[model samples]
Target: MMTSRRDFLASAALLAAGLAVGPPLLAAPPKKYLGVQLYTVREAMEKDPAGTLARLASIGYNAVEGATYTGSQKFYGLTPSEFAALLKQNGLLMPSSHYRLGEEPTNGAPTLGTLLHGWDRAVDDAAAVGAKYMVCAYLAPAERGTLDHYKYVADQLNRAGERCQQAGLQLCYHNHDFEFVPQAGQRPFDLLLATDEKLVQLELDLYWATKAGQDPVALFRQHPGRFPLWHVKDMAKTPERAFTEVGNGVIDFKKIFAQAKQAGLHYFFVEQDTTPGSPFDSLTQSLAYIKKNLV
Candidate 1:
């Protein structure tokens, strides 16, 4: 086809318009999805779960990790499906959840969502709730026995991991300072690491690890690609060594985040056990710092 003078002028005008706008915005690089652990606002969640989630969503958190699941088979008083719907309504996801070891009897029956009694059911519920990972949240005083018991815990975690894998989810163990404490001249955390890597992984709690005087980088180097989740909590610098906002604390996050690939990090959640002020305010501060300094 032959172009007329009018068509030529029109094409030139279009080119000029494009040039005036400057290059097309190379679609702003995808923003990293930051997450928060619900435990950070436990009291608020316990009182008003829905409101708490909305507040967190407003704070720019893209995901949330659950911190409670009782024998009642309810997450903050909502069933798995209901809770999942609530999360979606607020534009959030539950990538992971915390569960107990269930080593002891509560009311003469093992809790439903624990490793002891109803783990398969727990796994099923976790899947229902849109969770990709199930974590052994904490070990109570009685559950944390000698090194031999630690071996038992490892085996149990492997079994649970296998179950989770069958449901297309991963199982992880969330560590506290107790695991790093030397027991029988061997760190129980090391024993827990004995779990089959294919079945189980670690959700390294950066604050507790630092509080115990363990280097997060050293752990990453020691077990490369074995960690998938992280609790990005921070520790205070005072003598008491309390919990604090992420960047306000002494913990060196930039140094540890640099090793994220080695740590096999897929998701991380900010958490503060006991915030000094309003938890939401504290979270806002932490998220601001993270956005400014870290990822």
Candidate 2:
């Protein structure tokens, strides 16, 4: 009933050849979701939010991080729910948004949606807009200038973070070169990092970090798992250190992105403070670079 000895030998040889050819090829890893910070195209959003969203989606961005949520109680003049609907219509997700700490005082009444003012309401709006992380976007000149100021900001961030956690959202601090500047022999960025990890996370901006002469990977090693969000932009090679499209400048994003796990990176947004031409054009270049090399 079985094969003859010669046939058995032939089958054995075929099996050995199959083994030599190696095991079945493994499936390629799932593509990571990449997003863009709406601030990259602020003007367009201000003019027409829905149209801007559609254009971004067409350019291959699956997600967007909001940069305007204050003053109007709306996102780009649309209520949180409306903005969320527009995003969904455009086949995009809003995973994170930017808010200010409100360290500086207003003229008459307190501003709403700031970490110092109406933070709980801000959290509600963030949730309504489908954001999982709310970032303290920037620090004004008056808000900084001293290490003590940073400690105060850290305390406020902790309180804000607690409220965010209650609402099922994470709080993060977005940094700039100013934080890296030494204040009385201490860096504010380091001071801010001392905040409770459970309460506050960091949104590291690669461009600003490089501008301040710090290595992004080194920071990741020092504060492993503290960063969950990132502003992905690049610095021009010239002395001006101008904003440039991703991969069109000097930052080694490939190296930085390789350390995403250590950085606790969940989402990153492409941002350019200013662009030479249309911002959408800049975003297109950055998205292409990220898809081709980094993601």
lDDT of each: 0.81, 0.81
- Which runs in model 1 stand beyond 4 Å of their true positions? 1-28
TM-scores for candidates 1 onward, in order: 0.89, 0.89
For 113-172, candidate 1 gives per-residue lDDT tens digits of 787778888899999999998888888778888899899999999999999999999998
Worst 10 residues of 1 by lDDT: 1-10
Q: Candidate 2 — what's its lDDT?
A: 0.81
Which residue pairs show collisions in model 1?
none
What would the TM-score be for candidate 1 when compared with the true structure? 0.89
Which ranges in model 2 have alpha carbons more than 4 Å from their true place?
Answer: 1-31
> Model 2: clashing residue pairs?
none
Looking at candidate 2, the ten consecutive residues that score lowest on lDDT are 1-10
